[model samples]
Target: MAHPDARGNPCSSSSLPAREAAEQALWRLMSFYDTPLADLDAAMAADPAWALPHVMKAGFLLSLTEPTLAREADAHLSHARALARHATPRERAHLQAVQLVLEGRWHAACRVWDELLIEHPRDALALQWVQLWDFYRGDAHGLRARPARVLPAWDEADPLYAHVLALHAFGLEENNLYPQAEEAGRRALASNPRVPWAVHAVAHVMEMQGRFEEGSAWLRQHQAQWAEGNGFAGHLWWHKSLFRLEALDIKGVLRLVDAHLSGDALQITLQRVDAAALLWRLHLLGEDVSAHAAGVLADWALGEGCAGDYAFNDVHAVATMVAAGAHGQAEGWVARCAERALGAEDARRTNHLMAREVGLPLMRGLLAFSRGDADEAVDLIYPVRSGAQRFGGSHAQRDLIDQTLLAAAALGQRRALGRALVNERCMAKPVTPLTRHWLEKLALPEAAQA
Candidate 1:
């Protein structure tokens, strides 16, 4: 006889103990907490025929996106496909979604997960996976709205309901619904303070609204909640450093870098990106962070070892390499990214398009700016401004590209473009010190400020 999960979702395995253990492991994995992969291994050992463990493992590996992990994920996918005959229709649908991801059709995989949610709204794994892919695809509208579509199906009684609210809050924030997003995020945090995503959602709202002081205080107050064993600790610290930078606390920013963001840059792409981004922002502001950036590049083993196929990582690689004065490596990165973009299959053709279109120009621009060729940098980046969103990154992360443009415009003394861009920023973030300083430097008349 088949068993049911804790929330009563059907499992095809006859071994009830193994099924329950696998369910627990899945919950941990979906929660973004330190997942007990060994528990899943034990459950699979208990009953090798149980398909859910293999399916979950496949999903986890596919999400990692590292080339080695991709190979491991493929092995898991093959095993899951072999065991799909033993699973129920629902589990089979999940296997199909995993197959789509393995095939590089992530959006199609998301659609399958959406269908599964429509049928099994309580599938935490499906909801989390879909949200992750939405972020990776830079689908801001999908990130903000998809969870709301399925939220009515969940109740406060559900075990993972708060996490769903956190997802909704993040989506709302990304869609520019700051007030609603903040409320939902705070509610989720109040219910379960350990929800790092909820904490991150609130940070996004605060950051967007220019509530830098409030953002700093909130993150500092809640730091303990998200500090230990949380995979997102570095990112949360990165957000805090943004708040510090906005406050003109350069010392604080560097302190955060040394205290929190310091690590092996090559081991985890996220940490490397964070380190590079933090340093790049300082570099754009004309701070002397070449040594720090060089330290970051020391670990960046590019070419075959790195996951350069991810356009997001490719951009950061360019930023750090340029900052470290490794112009040759940056150029090589651009070329390799172009090759990968052109060579990608139809499923991820959009990523390839982004690489060929925006990624290449952005990297070349960075290289030019680093070499003090401000005019060349501006020339290369201006035409690609509208297409930056085609690559996968948040508004704040992508802001680095625009900042490069602004810096190049100013450095090249292209007063017209500099005036236009600075005024636009002023209108959007009227109280921002950086914008105000730029406006003053531009010597724009008082009426133009209004």
Candidate 2:
């Protein structure tokens, strides 16, 4: 009694009502909105023998990258594995992928999903999960390639087609294909105005292109659709703040921080990561953001036990602590990252390699920058700048590392390096007020002369 899901893939559920509920959850997951977990719970309760629902739930929880949710995700994985006898081959492959993620073999799980998609190209769940982990692992090439591979097999009229486009759009943007990325993202929005990821992709294109005013307007134009009833609202607001920062609208940026990025409203780690990044940027610009930094630090401190699980999270947590002036706490956080990198049990995980290679140095450099050891910060961070992608974040997010190095060069009176860095930035984007400010701070000549 197999049932076809929204994407026309055969699911194991026999009950119509259960299938409907699962479809609802799948839509929620695709849109990054509403309560997918509740819908998933209902689906599983209605058909206890169904394994796809359990796999779906497990995959969603694992995507959060929070160690506290790992146990819950594992429980769902166990349920899916126990019912493997009843699962379709596609479903069973999903079970194996989830198991690999649970075991901290993210790259392996991605490969499993790749194989599954080759067999069942319309599996929306597989497409979404693999794209997510690809982003998490900083495989920018895979981000674009994975979705591009299965997109031709997807019917244009399918409901999930637009979401697939959104995924591909993001991938293209990550790989620096700005024109193609924007085109794909707009096409997705044309199909479904409520697609946050499409909106996010377009936003990224504008952000990278230094179209600050247009980026601000674009986000605001779609704010009504993505600003509520979703988990991604805080991040959208954070993106808006970046536009504001570029315009040197310091007051406007602070207003957004107060209204949305305060880290006081939501307890999600991703939101807090945005908060730390925004606050840290302001700190770098010589603004007194100690109060906001302290609030973000408090939220991160509550999850202190999960510090070393992911290098990206660990770096953000350390950034918050450093920006908050918790020097001792920042040191301890770096120590934990070092410990995880060297520990026998953690050594086998993909994140351990990430920590050892890039995370530890970045965190230590940030701490040094905070402590006024500008030369030491420059020494530590300059070497890892090119490889920062290994720690897994968008180009905009990883720009923090470069920003720190530039500031360190200026502070340490490394005049030649400072001028070169400033020149590089000027060449990348049209010089804005912020660029001029940086130039002035470093006492460099105007953008043209530099």
- TM-scores for all predictions: 0.92, 0.97
Per-residue lDDT tens digits for candidate 1, residues 262-322, read 6542356667888899898888887888788888877665648353467777888788888
Output the lDDT of residue 307, model 1: 33
**Model 1, stretches more than 4 Å misplaced?**
264-267, 305-308, 344-350, 440-450
What do the candidate models score in CA lDDT, each in turn? 0.78, 0.86
- The CA-based lDDT of model 1 is what? 0.78
Off by over 4 Å in 2: 301-304, 447-450
Q: What is the lDDT of residue 177 in candidate 2?
A: 97
Which candidate tops lDDT? Answer: 2
